[model samples]
Target: MEQTNQIERKLKLMHVVAIGLAYMSPMAVFDTFGIASDISSGHVPAAYIVVFVAILFTALSYGKLVRQFPSAGSVYTYTRNVINPYLGVIVGWVTFIAYIALPMINALLADIYLSAGFPEVPGWLWVVGLIAIITFLNIFGVKIAASVNMLLVIFQALVGVIFAYLTIRSIVKGPESFIPIGDIFPSGGEVPELFGAAALLALSFIGFDAITTLSEDTINPKKTIPKAILLVAGIGGVFFFTVTYFMQSLFPDVSIFKDIEGASPEIAVIIGGNLFLSFFLSGALFSVFASGLAAQLSASRLLYAMGRDGVLPKRFFGYLHPKFNSPVANILLIGVLSTSAIFLSLEAATSLINVGAFTAFSFVNLCVIISFFKHKGPRSFGFTVSSLLFPLIGLAFVVYLWISLDIFSIIAGLIWALLGTIYLAFTTNFFKKEPPQIAFDELEA
Candidate 1:
């Protein structure tokens, strides 16, 4: 295989950020706000604030790794290069689960929302249709995927702006005062409860790291990917904080929501009538589609990276389309897996995905610590703090969230890890040596 046969370099800073935001899906605040509000006792924004800071720390570490390695493997590449290849393989599998599960989650969400609007159509049909569309877009090329994501992200942001505007109007005209700033703090819940809520809220920020998986396909990845990572997280955090602040003001009581998942849509009706509700649903659908598309895109690249390294089968997973310069096989594989969403409940799907995401977060933080120690030299205190101290804090936060995950998620995650370990032992000839190594000198050139 040659470098020209691999993914083409076409993404810029804007395209990378657009894909990251699409993966984060600004409309996701609407999907999870009611649950977070209930958990935090009307302090949903407060929980988001906590998660935003925690994710920022981890995002900084991601910036360092992407700049150093500049490969599509993400945490897998970072861990393999800095820590150990076996651990990297494990991280790759865990990351695979996380990335693959996200698109399924989005597909399931789309199915749920579309099913409500069109009862005559089957939910499975919607899920399958979305999976097919996202797969096609991704297989076409990274540029097409980025372009589609840009349009979807713009529409979602516009919807959020309208939502914030209406929320402010309701606050000003209604009996309530506009300065309900107290609602954004954790007044009703204790620290443990607040932490739990923040952990759940952190799930909404998982997609920002998806940008790093495009290192191989990004121009000036060392510079562009890092800035895009921070921008995505920062912009997303502001969007989440502002939207949830207004939502908390409009619907202060969590008890009022008849359906937690549907709460935002219901609020849209109350504030802007049926017309706004229709627009809101449309925005939600587009956001979910964009998220799924980005998820599949990143997941396929991860698989392609592993395949190129001989960790996975090369003939299929590693193959790049000659014309499109995309991982067509891996894209179709994700599409096939996404159809399983129709058989799963949203709760079950999210729980499994959260497990993989938190596991990857914890290890990425650990990878930073390892990298810092491995490449020690005379450097400023600023370098030490950015690479070591911040990652340590992020490690603690993600470990806490990992321990706090539901029992089912913990059990399933452990099982997945166990399976990976068994496969590694067999592949490495009973732990006698490394599994395999792929020379990246040519790819890097």
Candidate 2:
């Protein structure tokens, strides 16, 4: 067997955090608030609060796993090392679906925003252009992608803060009719319904786990990756909370939005006029573009990890540029696949993306529990809280969210899992042998 080529460690904590933030896309709170508000009956911020707690627990579990086995595969490597390799293969495929779908969704949203601004330009053109730029940067190296993501993330954060300030200013300065604090919680709803709404809001937290995929490329993966995961989740949660609070404040009535998905841009127009509207739209477009870049970068790394492990064709998916130290073929593959978003509506594309993410989230929680039992022996109180209790709580939240997924998403997710099972069966020869493994000693050293 050819020796495994290691990815150079060039990413620091901030770089990983930037990549995570870029993947989360702070401006996403604008794009998703309408659906969340509609579901929660105007309590978008409340839903985010619930989902934030859930994500925090899962992020903790992720941190634990990364400390034990720092690798590029994220959930795939964790599950394979802690559980079974066959199951790991399935997790890898599911994660691939999530990562790939995310970039496509971002690309599609970016194109939609751009087309709204310039109706003369076709949406496909924006999609192609965005994918091409991201592909080029990722193939160059992780640091280049990280630098671009940092700049974009900073710009997006500034836009979000400015929008929130303007929204609050509008409320205080405008007519007394504005209800600033009323819409943060649901007016009237069952607990289960709030949980369901929170489930949808949880999708906004998808990118934090993308940090783990950069483990091989990060400095001190054991420490930096974990800290980045928590920081990303926390920072993103605060962004969601602050922005959604102001968003609901500005547009108190969800019924007014003719198109809930585009409500953020319209809110920008209402609060800050055409200039800020232009700023908001441009910021959103750039934010989603940066997100697509981060998503593609993480997805390629995941593919490279799987390829190196012999779970996939090593010659193609596994090979990195001798100098660039990047999974060039996988980056190109994701770039090509991302353009398919031009054919898909935003709703249809986004629904499919979360299925894999939710699946991986649940499994990662389980992997943490299993690892705790295997390594820690009998659980003490501290172990139970850290390993067993927290993960179980996290799993419960994930299961609730999974059950609440749209019917089409559920059907599609099941079909994807079934396909993965078939592929696994054939690859493993009916589970008679262990899947191929790549030792990490040299890379770790």
Candidate 3:
């Protein structure tokens, strides 16, 4: 086995951009081409406008939060400062689950893609292989991970662009033919149901906030974090809408929801573009690879910070590797939990993940709104309030999306909150005799 060196805090701005890029890839193309197709019914691409606008408000809030704290614990640290301490712990726990669930889904999809090539090899092997590779890179530290992510983001971007451009450019000869600019619209339906369907499918476009989770580790966190987020949303939005529209144009017969093998409507764009199955599968694999790396990197840092705050078991959560300077214990814990989740219920996992991520994103946004009001020093923050409750309106927008999530997701989120509460109570009871607990980093030094 190779011994890893401790990682120095030498990661620069472009590396931070790599983090945003790779982190955005996991579900970016998948949802854009897959999930977006489902609700779009030709109108789904338009919903990108709504999702992008909503994300702008959310990004504004996160930008403010990261500027305040240039340390780890992106959501947890922000929520802790803006809200109650207990709420912070709950937010951390749930976000951990969210982080884990995303990679699990991606890994599963990756394995499925692998299984196609190697019938002799089990799908689980590739999944575990990906985990081990990412874990090793992360333990080596962020800079190396960021370097790998740069290559990955490039690959995903190229594959996606090529797939889209080919489909669009070749539309003249492909089956069903590409719809011109005028074809993007709803045929006929209730306004409420149409919008709701758009919203339901729009959940796929939620990776920009996840990209913001790396805010704590960035150079000039405020400027870098906001730019990375806005970049992800802007680029992701335009790209997603373009491919989805072209795919719809290429396949006039297939409904977005209809499931079929490759060369069908689900994959009509690739099929029409004459892309080999190899490219499609490779792209999916790359998507999940980026997903796993980003999740493990961000989530490990989350645990490291939470432990430092004395919110969890310090021995497990707070222990940093002397040799690697990575949160070894926390990384192992997250890996085990995520691996265990491979066989668990995806519906439950997805719902829980979505709600947890949604809440954190909402809170991060809400905190920004509060921070601006609280510390509006001259030119303090953006946006002038025309109404008495401009802040309230922003807060309400976040909360409404937070509630619109599935009940299963809410229950899962609440369960994690309760667990955090229970653990806090136990720790308080056990440490009753101690005057004060030492910090994790203090123990390390």
Candidate 4:
């Protein structure tokens, strides 16, 4: 690839963090609060804590690997370089499921919001329109995408703060009192349910790792990318916990929400009334836009990485626009895939995401462990704990979350993995040859 046609390095730490938060969609705590609360039996905060703690370990593992292998392929690059080339191809292929499905999920959410607001307007129009706008922004350049997401993320944070304030005020004024701290914590027997809820909420934490996919686009990725990952996870975790604590405190009774999955708007109305509802809805739509933009951006980068390495058709997937220096073809392809959102439901799209998420998360941690053994490091306690113990804990949490997935997602993920294996075998001539590898030395130069 020519230098002029390559992805440009322009992102700073703030840009990376903004994109990560946008991808996570800070308002998501409101959107998933009802369902997660129901699953956790009104202990939404507890579930957030569970997921956040698990993700912290994984984030550390991601940080550890990105410093060594800071490429756009993320876990794919780490696993492939640390482990076997074939396994790396498989991990990359499976992780593609989450990357591709996330934009579709955002499209679905935008359609739902727009359709609810404009009953006379067609829903498909909203989905198509939103996808087109985001696709254009991403194709223009990653810097533009990151900038737009930064603005939208700011709006989302403002809404979260206002919603929290209103919810706190509402709780103080209402006849019902806040639940005791002890009641907010789950019992030993309820640990399974808590984990189940945490599994679902894992969808909200996708952004932290997604930031690693911008390794090539980020300035000083070895330092900036790793710090951004921790910042994203920490900021997202604190925001989610704070917002949900008030929300769970405000509405202990889930019965008030007529539709559990789509309860945030209702909660918005109760706390802030029609005016705040309008504000909340607007923010939610913007959140969807922000998320879709970042999701498509990350997905395109991953495809570019795979394509440049010949895992996919390099001519189509690896090609970057000479002027924009963006993966134009990959961005367009994801835009087309997002059109499937018009035919799919939110639950189905969400179900596809976690399968890939857990797979990538598990492998990233494994990469850290594998890399630790493959290389020689000091035998000090701190290095040993970080390199070995942390990843092991992260891997353990991933296993629990994987087991907590519903039967449908589990089966679907298995089928997806099998398909990837078949494709890998075909590409490698039934394991007779080694899989193609990304030239990090060339990329670094």
TM-scores for candidates 1 onward, in order: 0.96, 0.95, 0.84, 0.96
Count of backbone clashes for each model? 0, 0, 1, 0
TM-score of 3: 0.84
**How many residue pairs clash in model 1?**
0
As for lDDT, the candidate ahead, 3 or 4, is 4
**Model 3 lDDT, full chain set:** 0.64
Ten residues in a row with the worst lDDT in model 3?
436-445
User: What's every prediction's RMSD, in angstroms?
Assistant: 1.7, 2.1, 4.6, 1.7
Instruction: Flag regions of model 4 displaced more than 4 Å.
Output: 1-5, 178-183
What do the candidate models score in CA lDDT, each in turn?
0.87, 0.86, 0.64, 0.89
lDDT of 1 at 290: 93
TM-score of 4: 0.96
lDDT of 4 by residue, 145-226 (tens): 9999999999999998999899989999997677787887799899888888998887788899999999999998999998
Could you tell me the lDDT of residue 192 within candidate 4?
81
lDDT of 1 by residue, 1-445 (tens): 4545467799999999999999998898997888888877777878888999999999998998888888899988888888899999988887788888888899888888888989999888999999999998998999999999999999999999999999999988997654356545665436667777898888888777888899989998889999999999999999999999888877778788799856887889988999999999999999999999999999999999988887787788788988889988999999999889988888888887887788778878999998778775875799889888999999989888877778988788888889988987887787787856756665562
Flag regions of model 2 displaced more than 4 Å.
1-4, 176-190, 376-378
The candidate with the higher lDDT, 1 or 3, is: 1
Q: List ranges where model 3 is wrong by over 4 Å.
A: 1-8, 26-35, 174-190, 201-205, 211-213, 256-275, 372-383, 386-400, 429-445
Show the lowest summed lDDT stretch of 10 residues, model 2: 176-185
